[model samples]
Target: MLKNKGKRAYRVLDFLHEHVIAIIIAVVVLAGVISTIAIVKGDVKTSSEKENSIQYEEMSTIYFAMDPVKSLNPLSSQDRDVYYISQLMFSSLFKLNENLNIEPDLVSSYTANSGSGTVSIKLREDAKFSDGSRVTAEDVRYTVSQILRIGDESPYYEYASKIDSVKTSGSYSLTITFENPNDAALDNLVFPIVSSSSYDDSANKIVGSGQYAYDSYDSMKLLKLKPNTYYYGGVPQNRIQFKIIQDKTKTTGLMTTDAITAYVSTAQDADSDAEDKKLKVTKIPSSELEYLGFNFDNKYLAKKEVRQAIALAIDTESLIQDNYGGAGITSDSVYFPGFLGTENKGDFYKQDQKGASELLQKSGFKDSNEDGILEDSKGRDFQLTILVNSNDGSRSDTASSISEALNQIGIKASVKKVSWAEYRSEVRSGDFDLFLGGYQFDKKYDLRSLFSKSNYLGYKNDQILASVKKLETCISAEQQKETYEKLKTMLQEELPYYSLCYKTYSFITVKEFTSTETPTFFDMYRGCDTWKWKKVVVTEQKDDE
Candidate 1:
């Protein structure tokens, strides 16, 4: 048996030896196939892992201050904080620039026909509401209706009353009929436009077409906003959060506590934040006009040449630099710079003492007794008194400067710094020759009623009336600009009032952010979409055991 087993084993070994190469090759080929499958599986996994990997995204946010409990209705809310916040959540057909110029907003093109008392406006086709509804002619008309229904209670009542009616032709086409031919429809139509489809039920929801959409709000705490997806401007990772505090006086404190990001204020003094925590500021030119007025009822002041000579003698640039903290601008008129009438005009009221002296010499005025004081042809001394509010140090100082200038010109001039009551009484009674005063006009820049204002200056001029008539017929922007030049010329000839400067307000931000266009009161968030901001991180140290 052992011999047979050995012989079989030997025979199997001999057969295996003869085909050893084929066995080895078969083993290697099997290993290669298995390894190839494993490699293919590994490559598939690597590619799938790479395809699924992605960079995370972050949403940007802004924190601001507003009245917590007050209504956020843009049309009726009188709170300035509410007004400013509404600028973020609302859209207007027109917007005011930093220079107070009327610029198109929702409207792509507009044309006014003073002869027909109608204004045709073509809305931007891309315009939409926060609710993703297309902004239509009906929405504009509906907004005007709301403003009208609010009546005098709304801050926009004056502007809304100028529109006789709003008619819609198509989704983006509309016409506004003014109550009067001379009314500036483009200026008056700047009121905020809300969604007509939702306004009946969502008036208190603060929904409108703006840079941001309302996401959440707590009356006592905060108002959260989400991006308006329907907005065609651009898709950004931005959000807006409004901190609701009761008192306007607490904005600076909230900012100091790192609870808010930015705010709009009259000046740096308005913010009570610590000096170490400084804010980046952007100045907004206001429609407030600080001017020097003349009472034409005065005997010698009634003369055109005397008023012209006095206007030339007053040094406006020096007064603005000294008394105004160099924060104001001297437009050629009582109207604001870049306003309707002063857009293209030069600095006509600059100090020209030589010209003033020459004009005085030609106007039959002389120092009769060589006492250094000039007397009129009737032997009357060139005497005047400037009235100013005693409490307003800036105006008082400006009045004093004017008095000094008049005295330097050999005239007996003095400043009458009186109490508020006395100043108001004198101004209303027209009992003074000259008064230092200011007017805070709305975004429309309409001061036409000043032309007929009685007990103020007693200024009556037929040329002014004619110029106003001409301005009424202006329909296009070019025509308005041209007609305003005529009105400026008339004002120059009459010289009823001399413009000193327009006050400017400050907008402070926690981060270094800039706007695409100069900021204005009506549209402070004009270019907020592109506003680059950085989060201010504050490190707080806790107790260590």
Candidate 2:
């Protein structure tokens, strides 16, 4: 009977196709037939009700939120969302772990010689691409070549620029030479490696050996992903989906509305908002260092005593609480606390009103007229103006607080807020006394580039730069850490720049997970490779009379 029904249905469809075009349309419309998704953006209702239908794995699945993708090519595009989704589909030789330490990913191990500026890497024999092909040393060479080909536009350019040459010893052994001795050679090799044989430069196709593989993509809606069967790492989530979000500000709304299950955000109120919605939010510390930049050329402002006094007057603890909502780590040193097995001596540079006054008096500055303002021995009036970008609410508030603190300490100060363009112009032109600045250091924490930039502030300190060079040549990690300690001490003593606090970001999710590793700023999806999921349990309760 079933076979007869199938034959009759086939015949009816064939007759309809040969007899009338309008009847065929009616049949398709009635049957809810869906066509293959095309590359287009609109609100057209797909017959399946969703664009690019997903094929789920036999295990668990997770939906993640990302901004609209302009291109799937992670190397060529400037989209952070694209970079993030690509991490799920691609594997790299080295990756930043939960503690922001560089560890081997696809490679078995590596040997570096700082004296020779060379590094030798051995790939994992079991490593394979999504196509089940062995990852060769040639592929590593090709990946670095592509990054260098993109010039400075590629985010990996800075890391790749130090690589003077790449030479493959065999199918799985490769050697990299740097322009000069670099202690961060291992950290610089954290870029993703692609299969040259499977990927085409002209096309935006991605072929990687990560935990997930490309399943399907609907132009303006969402991209579906399936598990990579050849993946060596354990697949925590069997399937994954990335919903296209054109506006990032709508992430919290979509999460509450069930449009997406999880997302990562740096917004100040992200944690609070998640609490209101009863969603799980993980607070993670980011590496973006927030600090105060000073113009050292001004004679009166160039005194170390004056800078130290100002630093003491500004309450860093209060700034972190008021401006950051207590979502930051306060520090007098620029380095992240406890990094590289380093120790911090308590009260090294905490706020002290008496200490601040003593420093000002030591600098030969005093309130000669007793009018709540300071003047030099020569009766020279002193004042400072802090420049901040108007778009950043937190930094703007910080500037205002610093201004008020200085006023209370008998030092005249004010804040100047401007658009991003004008802020940069004023700093570069040396038209400002002080400015609020932030730097998102690379995984390597390359301080050389930061110190070697053109003399925009006309700030000179040969001793500090020398210390950094020494830090680069240290052969052992222990020696490097010791050298960095010396460098941090010099920075504090010289007061070339002021170190403020490090901020934190939040990762909010609506789904229940059995287990998950902490994520870091270097890789927000650090847990995807090992995360375990659990089905949401629903309970029903009854009220009896």
Candidate 3:
């Protein structure tokens, strides 16, 4: 009876064990199905979040055949573009706003003590560099010292000649004392500040107090900048990519292809082509002045009447309307329109071909050969060589137009096209007679440097120098203006160079990016750290969908 009962119990236990195994298998299968669904749902949710939260990345680049001199140091290159690019990587004590008015960037405000040749600057306490370091008055003093010490042959040295000492009085205050007070003394203080620690000899590495810092730069290839995480102000877009496309035509092509977002203009009319379809163009008053500068030592240019005749003969208005697309303004004097003390009364200059011809005849140039060409009394043809940089479109065009105009007046004018380097060398050595060049006027409206004894042209005028000195020392703005006006009238009479026109520059940019303020001669890239990108429609994604 016991064996039979045990057998029944064992049979029941065996049956239950078999059913439990089947149930366990079913539960495992069900769990696997549920886990698969959860994973699929999580993946879908992650993809949606990525699409919604990610910032759209875009890049804007400028093309130039020449690579920027590896340093963002202000004293590195004299080229305006080099300075421009460096401004993006460096911060200045003072910056100019759209109206060509002085606006403080790193500095909140500054006062000039004309009598002591001293300048006191107040900095914004909240100003911090691209690095996490705070920018202090000590940085300003150090920058001034570095510029004066290391920048011997630099343009900065020439501008900062008056500065004898620089020191910090407080955490946010800086004092600069000049040995001699010059009118352009305060203006010369505008320079980029760099940390002594970050400055290294590495070719493309940049550590700056700017809106952007170097992400990567391969010589003559591409330069990439990423927004500084520690920036104190508005940050630029995620990245800025600079591609090296030297050919202007190719640059425009890249714009059409959507490979580049913008192109800043070196030409007056950069928007006059096919790329306009994708870009909006804005014109800014340029500080650039296109002129015909005679090597002062040139025998032919030494004659006052000869210089006057050439100035009179050039038809500025026709050249402005034709080559400049009616975008240029006639310059009556050396000072451009926006200078502190410049007074331009339009009638001071007249485009009188008849008057020019009379002056030429009086200067001993006559149509002796009946070939419609003038020759001097000594049979020296009234011919002049006008040199221009081949890369400069505006200057080259103006040179050609002037040649034509001179031909009309029986004066033989020849346009000599040369590389910019060669032209600069020739102009500096005083080897050429008349060269087509441009002077970029700075914020102070100082022309003394241009006409100084040791300037590029080596043109010396004591009267002009004295006037510039007075303008620098004058405490009152009105007094400074009066002094500058006096100097302009005097320089205009001398005709050191034929001031053709003050050019206006136009640029086409993507509307999503903010532009520098008006009369944009001052550094446009100053507040780049503070520039924010507006929303852009990424055409890569379908809007309708």
Candidate 4:
């Protein structure tokens, strides 16, 4: 019966095809008939009945925000907040490509000048700044000179510490002489270029030869940017909006309303918004590690047994999974995952409640009050105040979980959450026995701040310090790995900061945009150059009428 019905339908279609115009008209009518049937069957409807197609060409404004301070001139070199902006709006001789590999941006080619303490660079003749000024060797010379004169205040100061001088041979060639000959010099040259003409007054005019130019600025709330058509590389799609909408709820709301297209620092909140079906969430591995610093300055924390007991009592994995909803990787060492220093194949810490009880008992803690809480042999309860920056709920919740775990082992713990500014003050003043903190690794991967005598924790181990210095000068990758491994082992033993977890950084965008997981301020709009709104097609089956 089905085959005979198909044969009759084929015969009718063949007769319709025999008359071309009639077939066209008949197909149009058939399409209308199918459309009516689809409507009746509740399978297809007018697009106006559904969500409006996402606006694509109307200045695809992406609101990108970060938890950062307002301003520091890029020329200052030391300020990340400023460097991040500089990286986007400006270009350097060397640039990191999508694969995170070094590539040329302003300069066409480079060669190491052996024995001359210099690296010779050949500039791309056509490269010109947004102001229509030709990017010359003098620009590089002047930028390096400004960084040297600016000293420690510049974001590039540490990177520039190797540069003895920058000499321009001609309009298109430059020589970068280093104070110390190191292989990292080539990598450090990736510093964003600033116009020599504006170096003295760079804070006002941050002109460069990059994808976008500074369009407008708010006192501290925002920095608006527009595409620079004169850009030597790929042109950006639309005006870039950098907003400081720090409130998580406000950020989520903006994304839902299409007021913003991208945001930073909200893995916890983005997860909540993913259910809306209009948003896309991605977790990317970042070189960020959160830690709990144990105060070496405090008499109670000076005891190694006390530190070990606390470490054993705190269940970092459970804290990360339960409180943070598994948004991060449980850290066993100081270095974050994907970093070279990360001790991937080693065992650092594991949960053991029985072991924790034994460690506490050995540390001379007794349950003297008949309550579950343990006290020192002197009947002093093992209680301490934990301080964390109040802005992060995930960190606060992790702290609360740690507190609960410690209580399980008879250690009483309380949390003290404070404003970020106050938290910084507390960290610097050595006012807390324990504090929740995180570190952003410098280009050199320096751990000096954490173990140096100048550190907030006042934790100093001679061997660890020696190993760090060795880690700096070691040229061989194997030697470097050994030194880093040794340092990690020692740091874990010292327990300066009970390494908590490496949190995943997320960048959430709407379905209309295409973005990459690894973000770079230097080329924030690199993805935008080719991005176009794709019309998503949804098809429905028509019912026979």
Give the Cα lDDT of each candidate.
0.75, 0.76, 0.68, 0.69
Using all chains and alpha carbons, the TM-scores for the candidates as numbered come to: 0.79, 0.80, 0.62, 0.63
TM-score of candidate 2 relative to the true fold: 0.80
Root-mean-square deviation of every model: 19.0, 17.0, 17.4, 11.7
Ranking by TM-score: 2, 1, 4, 3
Top candidate by lDDT: 2
Q: Candidate 3: what lDDT?
A: 0.68
Q: Write the per-residue lDDT of candidate 1 for residues 1-545, one digit (tens) a residue.
A: 99999999999999999999999999999988887787778743422233223222222676777775467778888777677777777778887656555678898998877787888899999978887789999989998898888899787888889889999998999999988877745777777898887875325686688777888878888888778777756553567787777787766667654466667776524423433467666666777788888888898788888888888898877887789776676777666676663553535767888888888888888999999899988888889999999999899999999998888777789899999999999988988989999889777666566776453788877667655555544355667677777787778777788888887767767644444554576665555555555654444444333
Worst lDDT run of 10 residues, candidate 4, spans 516-525
Task: At residue 522, give the lDDT of candidate 2.
Answer: 69
Model 3 deviation from native, Cα RMSD in Å = 17.4
Model 2 lDDT per residue over 355-435, tens place = 998899888989889888988889876688999999999999999999998888888899999999999899889888889
